[model samples]
Target: MKQVHLAAILCLGFIPYSLTACHAQNKTSQELNKSPEAANSTSETVTTPSSTQIQQAYKVNNIAEFNEPWAITPLKDGRLLVTERKGRLYLFDPETKKKTEIKGTPKVAYGGQGGLGDVALHPDFANTPWIYLSYAEQGQGGYGAVVIRGKLDLKQSTPQLTQIEKIWTQVPKFSSGQGHYGHRIVFGPDGKLWISSGERQQFDPAQDMKSNAGKIIRLNDDGSIPADNPFMNQGEIAQQVWSLGHRNPLGMAFDPKGQLWVIEMGPKGGDELNKIIKAKNYGYPLVSNGDHYDGKPIPDHSTRPEFEAPVLDWTPVISPSDLNFYTGKMFPQWQNKAIATGLSSKAIIIIDTMQQPAKEVQRLDMKARIRGAVQAQDGGIWVIEDGPQARLLKFTAL
Candidate 1:
């Protein structure tokens, strides 16, 4: 393991920002005011000044490498499960530095931001051993995100998924384009399955209750609609919705207090960090701190009081990829905080979610497009880089 030095403090200042859409490939890319129109509302921006000083914060170990690696999670037995964007899965043993490819990952519609996505273990995995996966698939219209689960059979010579079953799917496959398929999935503390389905870059669907796009979905662990879901009476499609009006909500996590939060990519500016509320409308296409790619202006959240506003937003988009709340002993200072991986910003943003309105406190520069970050069993952090030949890095105390 090599000791990595991280800049401890980054002095804040204003910098000009240009808006552009970013994907896995090349695309060029916060604080203080509480006002929705205040583009500088972020307590700090991820764009660090060149004069910032550096210091050692943690020792980083390159655990393994994968092609276009996306999400990662630790298993009960100390092994790690990682997903590759091109429809592949690997079971990695950290202690042995060995990676075993797990078979049976469904073929994905792998192109233009659509591919294998998040991987999560069943909350009751010790007994059930069910593993869940989210990915993009090609259909009649175009492409859409889908979630599936299966029992992980490890006793065989090759670890593979069995009895795979589809749990949820983004209805009405979008023909708009191949962007913003937010297939992020998480199991809430209440044992309900939660999913963030992006609007597929289509404006109107975010506010359309008839479609499941651009909404947060909640369901029973077995893929059945929960009786108490906020929109149970809306329709079969709306029955799965927990909340509506979101853009590309790529990350979601529950804090120590069990409150859920999401980090999503905003337009040219206005990346958002939202505290999700059940059945609330986040006012995406209708209202945003950002504007359309064509430079069309969208009203600020402040203009619409009925719609929910983000607790924190960034002027120069962070292009946040994934999120995890720190609840570990290794980094006491980061305890109960939100760790958001940045793609365009190329850093790990640490936010104080416990505050009245969550604010960014620090950024750990990785100098690479970060796809995801998760807590290790020992209270350290495992970070994955984006795109081809991506490295899986483990971060522990210095």
Candidate 2:
């Protein structure tokens, strides 16, 4: 097994992950009042500033429009393949502002946070044009998240999907309204697909090896487990199990050095950014930086030295949704920095990496719930907003 060393460099002063139970506390009507700025309103106001006023040296340019876009991936041909939560995939040409919806996607359960999720092109897409997708499917018990693969038929004006096949499905198919199906997919350097599964708020299932509910699963392109998978020999352990003990992991990506990193949401506090390792357990229900909403105490990561700890974590909850590492030339200063979008904190957090572990350097408060951020082929940064009337925006140095 390959090992990556992680060391704590910059301490943000201890922000305890444990919090007092707010369950019995009366739900104040004021708590229902949404912040005017965070409220979802459809207004086409072009707020542009003098180029010189841009301090971070980047400007946001609205590139295209979509209906609740969840993820975007840049193709080798410079076009972007964007996925909408309505079980539709579209091809967006930034140069021409042309958008065409691809047909032939599997049926998706689109409602209350469950729908078409992440879409990633295969690493060898230039030759294969194979695209991978994660979405909520109505199954035996209820709705569960599923990962599938299909070929993109780009020869037509409106591209379509062909050869569609379901690769993996979360077991037990139980639905709990808003399932935390943390469906982010990425193709690793080894050509295996790494998927982050949310615990569906079931808690105990996160530690279950037989169930695939809350685990980081590694699978071949065709959705089969690699024979050499760490738990392949264990009968009860799912062959797809790469690591266990995860809650709602929304952010996942690889650095230039080939290390896999993941960010997951903690209870009330204790949102974590972890460096993923093979078969290493990340303390969840047993040990966490945060306590249960019912005020039950959970052990801290320190309590179990055997389980791996997050390299960095955020108190008060950043609600990190997506992760990307800057490898482009536009922001030379941000080279190798891990860029994460904060959904609750409404910021784009940049973590600077040294020789060992990475540390948070700056948290740029966009004042918008950033759902996804990716480095464009041209070195610019592209970000997608989280709800209805979401705009696909591009950021370039001013």
Q: How well does candidate 2 match the true structure in TM-score terms?
A: 0.86
Enumerate residue pairs that collide in model 1: 30-42, 30-44, 30-45, 31-42, 31-43, 31-44, 32-41, 32-42, 32-43
Error of 1 at 121 (Å): 1.0
lDDT by residue for model 2 (176-267), tens = 65567888999999999999998887888788887887789899988888887888877643789888889889889989989899998877
Clashes (N, CA, C under 3 Å) per candidate: 9, 0
Q: Give the whole-model CA lDDT for all candidates, comma-separated.
A: 0.80, 0.75
**Model 2 alpha-carbon miss at residue 222, Å:** 0.9
Residue 48 error for model 1, in Å?
Answer: 12
Clashes of 1: 9
Best by the lDDT measure? 1
Tens-place lDDT digits, model 1, residues 191-279: 98999999898878889999899999998888999999898888999999989999999999999889999999887677889999989
- The worst-scoring run of ten residues by lDDT in candidate 1 lies at 30-39
* Model 2 ranges off by over 4 Å: 1-56, 355-357
